[model samples]
Target: MYHSGRLGIMDDGQSTVLHDSPLSQFADQTAEFLRYHVLSAVKLLEFRRIDWELVGRLGQVDRLQQLLGEKFRLVLDCDAPQYYELALEFHSTFQYIHIFNMTLPQFAMATGFYTQQEVAKPVFVSLLRGVMKKQQDHCVMKEDLARFWVTIATSPFSNNMVASDIRDPLYRFVHKILAATLIGRHEDDNKVNHHSLFCLMCMVEGRPANLASIFAWSMTRPKKGGGKSRMFGGPYITWLADNLGVFVDYPVDRMHTGPALSLMELKSFQQAGIITCDTPPAWSSIVEGPQVQPPPGSAADAAMQAAIPS
Candidate 1:
């Protein structure tokens, strides 16, 4: 005979017992309910025809908020795909309020979604920090980084107090990416440079002083050969060459002076596409490769003959 305990346990004669704590049982029940009802509610709310007034009257929004609050940890920490889906759905459906209401730390954890939406200063800072830290991870996806940059460029975070607050981190991030590109460790160097340049441009927009510093930094970097070259080959360098007008006229005389290439030389190189190089081209080839002549009446002749016949 089996003996049952108050804690929902059964002892089958031996000391070995099967037990389920009431708390654990309650948690399991709660998870099941969320999996069914909460997830369904999110799905229903995602549809276009669903009336928001009706949804509010039905208390679906309140129910979702309650369920999400209860299962926040479970949904975020779980490795299951469905749990992630639920989190994303809840986030997208209630983005306006939920994103703004969450604390910075909480926003950081859900940056993958927050970054895709409009973000305020605190949320932007949190997302930027999250992306920077995530980029350091070995398994971070390029798409995630790309999305982060896109968000930064398109959002209103730039040209405001938020930009001033996050400027140091932004500069550090750009410097790290530039260093990687110079070392040739980055696989898609061109793409990385393009995104990085856009980010910097947005950051320095309406601020010529910041633009001057970035311009000087690019021009002052060591060249491929011995002395400093104005037209060094890199993504950032290329961007500077194209946007030379923005930083050219900035009065940097009062500011700290360094071993930067002169504005005249930069403009010359930009206009003439000429670089001061000591070495000549090595192993130059013709613009077009040697052409090959086809065999007289080869496959073409055979196909024509076959088409004319059977």
Candidate 2:
């Protein structure tokens, strides 16, 4: 059934899913759902699923209907496609940042220390240790995050892996998700989720969050796949080159940074003391290739192409 990774049935059966092919959930996602609802290039990105519960359990919490929520939306009618592309970038960015901000400490324990030998060990390690101490019950304070960003942003050990590209947008996004979401009636806004913020910072840069090139995409996205091949017009690249440039000068920076790493780098980062793994992550070599999907179009498109089955 997954031969094409999509289903063509049009009936909106109670269990049937309304999917976007290329399934824009921004398109082409998991095969378990119906994949016949391609609308247009300018489509809506409904809320996403986190799948926190244990795998292989029966009954999903956010059934198809729940994922297609009623409140938030991003509609592109006459808006330039550049904005549309930017929206996609933010969507990916939000997912990654939230996950990391919540789990800041745990992530630090694992991949945080291995800064690729970029910094003076004593100075950098001390800063990293102080940063790790800020995690209070998995959630960090707003100031905490600010300092955190500074710690990594100033360090060469975390380049490209934590803060993504250029750092400004991530500042805005971190506040939006981490600080904003935890806010409650003024006096009670504290506890946040323990997260892999480093991983997320890398993602915010526009390429999918590959995490030292060892993790699978959190879900299917950046369908272009990450690597030297995936960098040309990625969201972050466009942002820096098209919008602003600092240590990065668009094409030049693009070439300098090299493209996103492939799965092979996982083995490269497993230094004796750095990664300290007895066994490799099963996901290291795994890469998500885009799947064959339903054609991109809307009902009008189908009608126009319809040679009704007489």
Model 1 spans with C-alpha error above 4 angstroms: 1-124, 127-141, 144-257, 260-310
* Candidate 2 local lDDT, residue 195: 31
TM-score of predicted model 2? 0.18
lDDT of 1 by residue, 223-294 (tens): 221122112212332232223342254322211111122112222221222222224311111123223222
Those runs of model 2 whose alpha carbons end farther than 4 Å from true positions after fitting are 1-115, 119-140, 143-310
Per-residue alpha-carbon lDDT of model 2 for 1-310, expressed as tens digits? 2212222232233221223212124333432222211211222221111222311121322331132122110110011112222323333333334345534223322323223342334433322211134454322234543433443333333323232221333232232222111110111112122233432232232212122111112222233322211211122222322333322422332221212312112232233121224553321121223322222352323544574675
Model 1 residue 32 CA deviation (Å) reads 57
State residue 146's C-alpha deviation in candidate 2, in Å: 9.9
Candidate whose TM-score is highest: 2
C-alpha RMSD of candidate 1: 29.5
Query: Model 1 has how many clashing residue pairs?
Result: 0
